[model samples]
Target: MRPILSALLLVVAAGAVAQPVAPGQRLDGIAAVVGEQVVLYSEVDALVQQTTQGREAPPDLWSRALDRLVDQRIVIARARQDTTLNVTDDIVSQRVDQQVAQLAAQVGGEPQLVQAYGRSIDEIKVSVREDVRDELLLQQYQGRRMREVKVTPGEVRDWFDRIPESERPEVPELVRVAHIVKIPASDEAGEARVRAFAETLRDSILAEQATIEDLANRYSDDPGNTNRDGTQNGGLYTTLRLTDLEPRFQAAAAAAEPGDISPVFETPFGYHVLRVNSRDGNRISFNHILLQVEVGEDEAEAARETLSVLRDSIQAGTPFEAIARRHSEEPQSAARGGYVSVPQTRQRDLSAEGLGPQWRATIDTLEVGEISEPAPVTLADAEGTQAFHIVLLQKRTPAHPLSVTDDYALLSQYALQEKQNEVLQEWVDDLRETVYVDIRAEQYQPPAGG
Candidate 1:
């Protein structure tokens, strides 16, 4: 779940209450005041309820939630004053649409979602749009603040030294690896077969022989068109932006009107026959039937052969990075000269346990600086699509005590985070001093365990 969607859910859930109070009467009291904004007691209660979720609430929960709300208001006030910060309507609209779609899916559909939330879809969107903007503003402000923080090598060493020798954490066995990936080529015959199937589905829908939903349930290969429990989603996608889609798919949809069927089109994923359910400018709601060509054993073998030749060339003095850049099919690894970093982290080093069984077995016997023979594996970020790759084990460090000299990259990340937190605390303190703040709620105090 995205933060925005989660937030929307919480807000929607909290606001669904019905009260007998007069329209002009305030149902909730103010918990705090930060600058021009007030944090309501209801808001604090909502957050505490979410955090506790029926678990016994701690004594300080309300105070902590109030503190968080006040801090957010302070930051939001600062963001509003900054001329440089902008969260455009388009961005807000797209995010709100995504949240709606996700929430709608969970609650059965848009109508069900509207009924559950006690608001029309448009009203629901209007309610959460500003919240989305605020969240985005907070993200932008925090990003800018964190960017200003930096750590020196001396700081990293000092951070490591501060940890007493007896308390030093043991380093796990880590492997830094690289690979040249080759997606199996789609044979001409297979492509023709898949395209023909897509055309047939398009024709069937056009002739009223079948509904798009029925065909999608039976044949659509797109994983996004399915729910987790093996139920089909009828291939529905809501408020899809043109730029977010595959180029050919986007082009096909762009040329079509609402209720018009797109001609069978090919994207990197498969051949698609799409129906534009509706369109509002560059954003469209659509249903699609996708048919993918399967790779035969011969095609898989050919990919392996290509990697085998590249492996030989690399072993015979050609640079692995150069060859990987030219021929590796996986975009992220290829862009980094085939070095596969741990996802969402800047560090290339990965613990052995983090590597999936397939990869661990592939590199189990490989020595440092040696390249393995081409082996079958699933490509990353490719939806478990089978591909072949040749691995290069760059460096492998056995489990040992943490040391500044051997683990500078790891130590540097922790040090940088520590410095960033210090900077953020000082900056927030400065903001609180300048900003007008009043607390009507009880202040949070740590429990005696501290």
Candidate 2:
């Protein structure tokens, strides 16, 4: 989330709430004021915490965050002065719901989410609503103030031409290729065997023969836990993507309630079982045991041979799309005829980067219709080494300089963004002049007297 959006939303939601000072409660002191709105130490602290929740921030982050909050409040206060800029409840509500949905998706599910945030779903919804309302108000104000802002084609061309050849945006060499994935399923006997193992483990835990943590260290499929205590410290299980777990594991995890231990479940990987430790909003903290399926060397060799034959058949005239639809285990891309759209340019170097180097090297050298030999590539999936690919290049675009005919959309976006920045800077300046702003003396003190 952007700092501007986060700060503005916080103000919208929590700003209007009555601040009743209790005798015992400590106050952090006021940082700044915009009209009736006051930026307090507590508010700034909250903003900083939210902004830096999952990431590292610099030492001056709090000061920068405070400045941004002050600016946002100023913008909102100025906008509210114009009665025409009043935001609607419907628009605010819709934006709030969208943001909430996105957050919910990130955490896992609603019940799990409540546990994580220590707040009910309704409370979260209300907070989101308030934040979104302020955001919409700010947007509306921006629109009204910058309605006439425009950039001409000549300006865009000039901007493009100003850049030297070395500085010009380089188009990435992209590959358009499709794939078919086949994941072999574990047999029913295999599943039953894994289930019995889970039940035995569960009995041992119940009987004091072993602890859940000890079992997790020995049996958990999660690499994060397999070597140490099976437990992922501090409810980290929610962060795991559903696609990263075996289908059966995902099903069990999704169905299990906080404190509930699930029976053994079978997946392509083998058999497993899990226990949900806690639920926070959409995120669930859980622990599991993994019984990996054992494949004979011959079986592994046969699977590779099968992929080789499929690759040959495609090269010999079998339609790639038909082959993928019939045999591909990857449900997501198989339906699209195995076409994975590559980005125009990658940031990493091709020669020494991990997957980055391989991708960059392969796409750069291969022409259309050429199929790379069946490479023993790692699966870019949770099922891990079970699936591999023999990539057939479908289309390739060479690197080139930007042009109006070929990159009008990109250039237009750049032009619009430049115009928007100008409008925003002007708005900020105008607000600074109109609003009553006072900076603390300590904020601008010189390092030392000359």
Which ten-residue region of model 2 has the weakest summed lDDT?
344-353
Q: How do all models score by TM-score?
A: 0.56, 0.51
Q: For candidate 1, list the clashing residue pairs, or say none.
A: none
lDDT tens readout by residue for model 2, 182-300: 54433456556767777898888767798666787667665555326543542135534332344345556767777766777665455566778865433356766666665445555
Q: Which lDDT tens digits does candidate 1 get at residues 1-450?
A: 113212211112222111122223335566678998777665665566556655878777667666666666777778777779878889889988998887776544776566545578998888888777877777787678877788998899999989999999889889999999998977889898888889899999999999998999899888888888977899999865553465456657767789988888776677888999987644578999888888988999999899999999997899999999999999888988999896646688898767888898888879998999998887666247789999999999999899988899899988987787677666776889878999976643322211
Please estimate how well model 2 matches the true structure, expressed as its whole-model Cα lDDT.
0.60
Report how far residue 140 has shifted in candidate 1, in Å.
Answer: 15
Superposed model 2: Cα runs more than 4 Å off: 1-30, 38-60, 91-124, 143-149, 157-171, 175-217, 223-395, 400-416, 436-450
* Local distance difference test, each candidate: 0.76, 0.60
RMSD of 2: 9.5
